[model samples]
Target: MTSMDLSFRRSNLLRNQPIGRGDADPLPLLLGQLLLRAGLPTTIERASSRPWASALFEGRRHSIRLHFAGEEPTTQRARFIAGLSEAEWRLPKYFVADITVDEEGSDSEGQWVQLSALTIRDW
Candidate 1:
């Protein structure tokens, strides 16, 4: 896996808050880490996110579509899902509460996997 520096800049809305008390969206960064850990040669077909918050916690619900093309795409797709499900992710300022394969299918050229995840800020 390639090394990455995952840093978040405080949103202007939280500028007046105390240090370490800001919310920076982590979905984009988290998606990169998720792809890396899966270890599949693929492209992100699409990504979507919606903000979510409760009385105490703030986070996002994410959906990602990945396309895998080449030999044995079915096998590669299986491994991709397994990798994400089994591996433990240690990301900076974020917690991946859940990640799962929501849908999958194949066409003449390749296979695609759709994943859903819930991520929360650690700060």
Candidate 2:
């Protein structure tokens, strides 16, 4: 098997949920789970409703940071890189970004809150 094939197999093992088979976004899912672990309500439709939203979502700033060990090919890593790249490309062309962070580092951390500011109004 090729290195890419081996990497993919390893990545899938680390995933909690299967790929392309969930109703909700993975990032949001993780955020919800984190909130629950912190004794906060996780069932809320909007993560912004929680107090943490203020810290994550400011006026208009979004950032995504990635941290990983030495350069070793893995399926999950490859998928993550590809997926995030796709998200970034689709972001500016199709979606509006209040803020976004695309960087790589060892000590990476970030937060994003879902705000209700943007909404469709009947004209």
Candidate 3:
């Protein structure tokens, strides 16, 4: 009878080494990449019905508020609102968000629009 040596298998060492690209802010770039997925392109209007995003629902229920800077265009704001509702459109995760476009006020810098976002996962 031949004795099998298990030392070789035990000696095999592997580690989960995550390579880093040293990106300062990769969210925006990643979002742009997600937008390029091949299919019916994510238009400004048909945002809710796509496989990317869910329509945001606001009511008296489980809710949380998040703040994100918006752009200077109404159309752009709308696009973000829709995208924020789905996990696919907004890379990373998904939640129902009430996106309110704030008026350019004393708190806002030049051309920097503020969007008050409230996210609710479920009723």
Q: Could you give the C-alpha RMSD of every candidate to the true structure, in order shown?
A: 10.6, 20.8, 14.3
Provide the global lDDT of candidate 1 against the true structure: 0.77
TM-score for each of the candidates:
0.73, 0.22, 0.24
| Per-model CA lDDT versus the true structure | 0.77, 0.29, 0.33
Tens digits of per-residue lDDT for model 1, 48-110: 887767898877888999888858888888777776765676767778888888899997879
Runs of candidate 2 with Cα error greater than 4 angstroms are 1-59, 66-73, 88-101, 105-123
Candidate 2 local accuracy as lDDT?
0.29
Choose the strongest candidate by lDDT: 1
In TM-score terms, which candidate is top? 1
lDDT of 2 by residue, 1-123 (tens): 555544455566687444433222223433333333323211223333111124434222222223232233233234334433223222211122222233322222222223221111111
Candidate 3 lDDT over 1-123, as tens digits, reads 898766544323354332232112223433344334311223211111112224654221121222223343344334444544343334233343444444322223212223333333233
TM-score of 3: 0.24
- Residue 36 in candidate 2 has what lDDT? 34
Error of 2 at 91 (Å): 11
What are the runs in model 3 whose C-alpha is more than 4 Å off? Answer: 1-93, 105-109
Count of clashes, each model = 0, 10, 0
